[model samples]
Target: MDMIAHNDSLQLYASDLYHYPSLKQPLAGLKSTKINLLFGHDEPNKKGVEDWTFSSDHRIFHEKKIPYIYFGVEDHKDYHKSTDTFQNINKSFYIDAVRLIIEAIKAYDSYLPIDSKD
Candidate 1:
């Protein structure tokens, strides 16, 4: 988290190999963007496989209370396999997922350097 802030990042949104078709869950930090609402809400499933708490990088942010979000999709047949090639990706879903992240960044940029009272 500090490293991201040191590098001048407004917020961090980590996108894995796949993203959900309609839901982009915010795994940690401030839920201050419309993307947070569009993707439902900031829900951290500490014990779940997709849980950001389990990710070493994300865990640092979570522990430090820094802003972060995680985007991912349910496991597919090709997950973690040789068959998981670029050509097998869901292009449309991936595109939308990227767009959503862009939108989130744009929205947050306008109100960045967030001042937290915590």
Candidate 2:
């Protein structure tokens, strides 16, 4: 979700930018490469396409009829059950997922401009 927020900001700036967890930290420079939209929910009962096109910056990204990647993980009894514990989490997979998002942000940040506007 944080990555999504940063991407939203990128849509406005359209230039190199980094969003740190804390304002006190230095921002890492980014290079905008491609738009990677992760659509889908982890919950079994919640699955659908997320439409960012209705957003104000809809015109920023090119539209296409092709399909996009959707993070569809199979839901189990522990999907959202209270029994879901950190010990049961897949650490490696989670780390890789986060790394991918970071890489995408870093790549896209380079071409973003702070003064970009509608």
For each candidate, the alpha-carbon lDDT, in order, equals 0.43, 0.35
lDDT string for model 2 (5-111, tens) is 22211221221111112211122333323333333232233348233332333323324422222222334455556656666655554454455556645544553
Top of the candidates by lDDT: 1
The TM-score measured for candidate 1 stands at 0.50
Q: Which stretches of model 2 miss by more than 4 angstroms?
A: 1-74, 116-118
lDDT of 1 by residue, 11-94 (tens): 234543122322232323334442222232233532444443444555565567554555444446666677676666655445
Q: What is the lDDT of residue 24 in candidate 1?
A: 30
Who wins the TM-score comparison? 1
How far does residue 56 in candidate 2 sit from its true spot (Å)? 20
